[model samples]
Target: MSEFQKVVLSREITGVPVAQDFAIEAMARPEIAEGELLVKNAFLSLDPYIGSRLKGRHMSGPAPKIGELIPGLAVGEVLESRAAGFAPGDHVVGESGWRTHCVMDAAAAQKVDAAIQPLSLHLGVCGMPGLTAWASAHHLAKVREGDRVLVSSATGPVGGTVGQLARIKGATKVVGLAGSDTKCRTVEREYGFDLCINYKDADWTDQLAAALPDGITVYHDNVGGDVLDAALANLADYGRVILCGLISQYNLPEGERPAGPNPGVYILKRAQLSGLVVYDYMAEQADYAARAFEWIESGDLRYVEDRAEGLAATPELFAKLMHGDNVGKTVVALGNG
Candidate 1:
């Protein structure tokens, strides 16, 4: 290909993301040099974490410069390789951004076995989002038998995965908090959460309390505004809060971010709140993949994808996801698979 299409940040975000914030541009196809590979992207992931990056607020690294490609995770096939250990037609997952093609160092891409799951899943449930849930719940939160767990943003990929994993790990009860009644229903009926509260409800806190009369022992938080405040209020003594994401505040102006899960509550309950960045556990990816794959094969873990067709649909899909219009993991198919 002489040229390829990619989305680039056209302006800095102020509040919520809008289509005007990004621009789709045609650029020359990337050239692979020695030790690098050219990836023809098939699927691009649209995750809540990318919203933080767009607002210049992500904890991971510096934000993308205006006019630069929007940073994201993607699954693709190696179209050309000048690197050892990879060849043409190999499926791989990497931080290939929102692009039709990318030139990446071979070391930056992980070869994926499509036989294990669908290729797009390597960008979603069986990928970073799934791994984040696995590590945060099982490792950071230390979920155990008989523990009552609560997860925020219950219909999203990470939250959905966390609830199921907590259930599989023998949590006595696993409840969820979602934005809408439909999402709450999906979280309960499809994801198997014991109960799901609609945060938009005026009586959501009461519903949460009713669902977990015993108090929450493990809290996996994705949204961090009122939901987090409510979760903290219900934490059992010595409870664990796995802080995986703060999607609620990601698009807000820094000064407008909500405060208070109240420090006094944490101290009074002696609760442990820990932040989780999946990259910290990269060394254990193989182990996680093995176990997650087994869970999928055995029908113990399930996932969903909110897919949009074509690269041109990415901006709208991302906007929809930010507005909670998406039901599961949001992905943009680029016609390469």
Candidate 2:
């Protein structure tokens, strides 16, 4: 066994995350057993999903058991293996959370072609983000040709792909909502969104309505609260909304559920809203990935990333994402290579 440096969760937390809450410390190496492999992490994901863990309502499983290292997803290289079909240097993606190293069973990790895209993308576009966009558009939103589609967090991994998928599905218009003017410009000029609006503007709702005069028929929602309310107000009759995430409320206190959806338009429009978790559709992620790859290769799909320097910056980068400070998938790179 050897002592290695890793980050651990802290006992205290304020409204926003602090570096102290995620302390880096030295720890002994984990022992390997049958069907298990030792991994050296290469890239760790910093996403809004982790904000839920800090609030103690993690939603994945029981509240993370306390004092554990903060939970997340990562990509790593195999260092030692007692597993079949896996050898040293093979890269894998798994729920190894925020750590420098891990010992995970082979069944829990999936082999990845890290050479095709950066390992960080295993947690972003080619991974959960890609799957989320595909399923929400084709399955939950039920988009059709000529439908008017709207996507929030336009440049974020999930919402960015949603707009592209809608366009590829023959949507007549794709309106994207982002936090900054720069992101708004990129979504429209670079990602091919028909219209883009900065949600931070006081008149954003009005601009959104003007962008889709016929009304929003499908909304792939990554942001909730005010944005959700505004979407509700602008939806067409029988419109479909895929409730992908509620990043707005992830940092709230324990036992404090965010307010319920506004009902006026929901009742009048008779809209159809569905909530989804990517894990629920794990059986089909591979199929979705294949489709995304095809679209990407054909120039119908695009992606962006906000790559940070080191594991030590993960906590701050996560906070920036929650505060709408990042333009795309936020990642923390750990290795020099």
State the local distance difference test value for candidate 1.
Answer: 0.86
Clashing pairs in model 2? none
What is candidate 1's lDDT per residue for 1-337, written digit by digit as tens?
A: 3359899989877778877888889989788789899999989999988888776678756788889999988888899999999999998888888999988789888888867656787876788888899897889987889999999988988999999999888899989888888888889888988888888899989988888887899999887777888888888899999987888888787666667566898899899989898998877766677788888888888887899998888988998988888898899988766
Instruction: Find the candidate with the highest TM-score and give its number.
Output: 1
For residue 264, model 1's alpha carbon misses the true position, in angstroms, by 1.5
Clashing pairs in 1: none
**Per-residue error at 311 for model 2, in Å?**
1.9
The alpha-carbon lDDT assigned to residue 186 of candidate 1 equals: 88
- Write candidate 2's Cα lDDT for 123-177 as tens digits: 7777888788878988888778989999998898889888988888889999999
* Number of backbone collisions per candidate: 0, 0
Residue 1 C-alpha lDDT in model 2: 23
On the 0 to 100 scale, the lDDT of residue 107 in model 1 is: 89
